[model samples]
Every structure is written in C-alpha cells, then in structure tokens.
Target: MKYFIYAVITIVGIAVIAGFFIVGSPGLQRLRRLDETRISDLQSIQSEVIFYWQSKEKLPAKLEDLTDQVRGYKAPSDPETNLSYEYEIKGEKTFALCANFSLSLGPEGNNAAIPIPARGYSKPGFAEVNWNWEHTEGRSCFERTIDADYFPLIKDQKTP
Candidate 1:
C-alpha cells in the first residue's frame, strides 16, 4: 500500500510539472505571434515609405501621408495592442519607424540575432538594401534614409 501511494504521488508531481508547461505555452506562443506580426507590419511600412519617397521626391510628413487611395496602401496598427505604429521624419531623406514588440529578437535573447530581410527596389542599379530593423522585448525603432541619386520619377494621379 505504501508503494502504491508513492507511485501515485510521483505521477501526480509529474503531471503537475507537465501541466505547468502546457498551460504556459499558449501565452508564449501568443507573444511570439505578436512579435512576428510586428516585424511584418514594420516591413510593409518600410516598403511603402521607400515607395513614397521614390515617387514623391520627399519624405512623408506623417504616416497618414502614405495612405492615399491611389497608392492602395494603408499604415498598419499593432496587432495585439491596436495602437498605431509610430512614425517620425528625421530629415529631408531620413525617417524612423517604431513599434512595440512582445518577444526578444531570437533564442539567444540578443538583438543581433534578428534578421532584417533585404528589400529590393524596381529601379535599375538600385540593389536590394537592408534596413537593419532589429528589436527587443518592448519598444524599438528603425531609421531609414533614401538615397537621393536613385529617386524614381513620380507618377501623376488625381487625389481621391
């Protein structure tokens, strides 16, 4: 009877440990999902900003400036917090995009582990460029500069 009791207690202890992880996993997964969404959202906004500079020959004064119906692009808000991503004009050809991230950039918890994919422009001789958008578990910002020599001609369109 004592042996049976010990076995039951051991099994119960193991079950509790397993249960802790099983219950904790969803929250971790949710955080990772939110981080991924933030990365993707920033990437999209980066692309649109580059396009806007190429077409307009000027940095957008605000995030709202990129939302023209003719461009068919809308700035994205945070997936989890529902807050608008932050944008700031740094200079004539420089700007910054900011977001809140829920997870560290990588398994090692180092910012350098985060990979910012190279974005390619449609223009000739303007090779793919990396924006170096890296983040940690809270708020992070990325700065970008448009090369003046590579500006593409702006397309004329009626404002909607």
Candidate 2:
C-alpha cells in the first residue's frame, strides 16, 4: 500500500512538470506577446512605406521620413527595447525591414506577420505586391521589392 501511494504521487508530479514545459512559463509567454507587438509594428510601417512610395514615386530615404502630421503616420520602434527598427534600401525599389525576434516562427508559417507574399491586392492592371512575413528566433530581416506595376510612378495610373 505504501509503495502504491508513492507511485501515484510520483506520477502526479511528473505530469505537472510536463504541463509547464508544454505550456511554457509566464515569463516566456510575456516575451512571445512582446514579439507579436513587434510584428504588428512592422506591418504598420510596411503599409506606410508602400504608401510613401506610391505617392512620391520613390521610397523614403529613412524611416523618419515616413511620418506626416496630417496623415497621423507615426513609425514604431521595438516593443521591448524601445529602439528604432532597422531599415535599408537594397535598390531603387527593394528594401528590408529588420527586427530581433525572441522565438522562432515554425516553417509552417504559423501566425506569420505577413503570410501573403506577392499577394495580388492591387486593382485591375496591377501585379502582386504583398509578400510573406515569417521569421525564426533571434535577429531576422524581411526583404521586399516594390512592384512597379502594382505601384506605378504616377498615382492612380492604370496599366494599358
């Protein structure tokens, strides 16, 4: 009888330990939430970047240039560190948005920031512009090139 009680107690303890590992600790969960916020901030900035390009027919030289008081456009920085996110123009229309992530988003693309890469969201006579936004743990960057057809130099200009 004594041995049976010990076995049952041991089993219960093991289960509790396993549950913590599966669900993760509270601190870890908090970090994940912060990463999600970072992703959201990046998405908002991306939209503004595209708009800036479309309106000006050129990409902004710096992220700071994205802000407009009338448009209420305010670029966001890192959530945890409260630092500016990394941005660079790779070419005429190509650019990269970078951030440091706490956890790895599986290759399955679960909860991807922008899963729709090259998505066709433009009006008629435009090519796809959106791109997939996925990342792994640690520092990562998402590179995208503006599609000229989708975003012509002239605002509201449709392809023939």
Q: How far off is model 2, as Cα RMSD?
A: 4.8
Q: In model 2, which residue pairs have backbone atoms overlapping below 3 Å?
A: 117-131, 117-132, 118-130
Candidate 1 lDDT, 42-144, residue by residue in tens? 8898878878887877878888888979767889999987988999989888889999887667545643343545454555556655555456778888888
RMSD of each: 5.9, 4.8
Candidate whose lDDT is highest: 2
TM-score of each: 0.70, 0.73
Measured with C-alpha atoms, the lDDT of residue 136 in candidate 2 is: 80
- Candidate 1 accuracy as TM-score: 0.70
lDDT of 2 by residue, 40-74 (tens): 88888887888889889788999999989998888
Cα lDDT, model 2, residue 35: 76
Question: Where does model 2 exceed 4 Å of error?
Answer: 1-19, 108-130, 158-160
* Steric clashes per prediction: 0, 3
